[model samples]
Target: MLESVLKTIYVIWYRELIRFFREKSQWAGMIMQPTLYLTFVGTGIASAMTFRQAPGGTPVDYMTFIYPGIIGMSVLFTSMFSGISIIWDREFGFLKEILVAPVPRWAISVGKALGIGTIVSFQGTILLILSPFAGLSLTLWTALKVLPICALVGFAIGLLGISIAGRMESMQGFQLISNFLTMPMFFLSGAMFPLHSAPQWLQVLMVIDPLTYGVDALRNAIYAGIPEAQAILQHSIAYDLSIVGLFSIVTAATGVTAFNRQG
Candidate 1:
């Protein structure tokens, strides 16, 4: 049974990978958005505003501060939209075939989430190439540390998209719902600005946003080498990881439940 489950997951994951590779346009579209934001938006903001509190008082600029948030943004957008592929598969009658297969439905959900997560994580990592431009000093060690956090954030967000997609029959509907959710999640996640000085109502929403912890975790990892990192971190690394991990578990279960219902 374990072997069967593993094989099913592999098949589903491989299929998603093949589809991703075949769609050459996806690479450009995904990479371009973050590049534009990091270059245009980041540069403009960095020049206009002087960030008073540089982590460790080490003169971290606005661009450096928002880099991890930009990575989170990339992961968020890519992972959330990835579920639209499910709608496409359904439209083409491919999902029906998969649903009728003898394998466990949960395995299918896990595989789909993992596949989307992997793709999103890769997209986030690609943004690391812009670290220097963002005024961040990144090394091989920093990249290694940042990779898994990106994967975890991607996986959690992918499961969320899968859970929503499992219930959505139309691509338009899925896109609409995802758009409604993505913007607020990104803004309140402290991606573009610090949350410590946010308004009370916004702070309330920030705490509830899973991406907040994911972004914070990314910041924690990215700033790990800086002195007095805690000055910049809202929570400890372990705490941030715990929240994102819990979110992933909850979303994974939700995705599996959605699949079971659909199946």
Candidate 2:
């Protein structure tokens, strides 16, 4: 039984990967938004204001400060949108075929999440290649540490998308609901700005956003070697990971439950 479950997951994961690679447009679309934001938006903001990771610690460039945020933004968008694949499967009757297979429903959900999460992590890594251009001092060690965090962020958000897609009947509805959730999550996640100086009400919202912890964690990992690391980090790496892990667990359970209930 265990072997069967593992095989089922691998099959689903492989299928998703194949589908993603076959659609070359997915590559362009996934990478374009983050690239544009990092270059144009990041440049514009950097010109207007100087940013420091911490008050009087070190004068960090605006581009450096926002680099991790751009990575988080990429992972969040890619992972969340990847859930629409479920709707597409359903529309084409592929999902029905999978449902009828003699495999655990939870495995299906997990497999889909993992498949898309891998894609999201890949997208995030692509952004890491641009770190130097963003004024960040990238090291091999830093990139390695950042990779796992990206995978965790991707898995958590991918599960969220899966949970929502499981309950959605149409691609239109899924896209609408996803856009509504993604925009707010990105803006409030401290992705574009520092949360330390945010208004009280905004801080509360940021605290509740799972992506906030993800971004903070990425920032902590990416800047771990900097002298101002402690001052710049919103929370310790352990705390940030704990929050993201908890979120992943909750969303995994939720996604499995949704898949189990699907008819």
Which candidate has the highest TM-score of all? 2
**TM-scores for candidates 1 onward, in order:** 0.95, 0.96
Could you say which candidate leads in lDDT? 2
Which regions in candidate 2 have their CA more than 4 angstroms from the true location? Answer: none
Which pairs of residues collide in model 1?
none
Per-residue lDDT of 59 in model 1: 57
Question: Per-residue lDDT of 102-165 in model 2, one digit per residue for the tens?
Answer: 9989999888888987787778778888888987778888888888888888888898899999
TM-score (C-alpha, index-matched) for candidate 1: 0.95
Badly placed stretches (over 4 Å) of model 1 are: 53-59, 228-230
Error of 2 at 66 (Å): 0.5
Q: Tell me, what's the RMSD of every candidate?
A: 1.7, 1.4
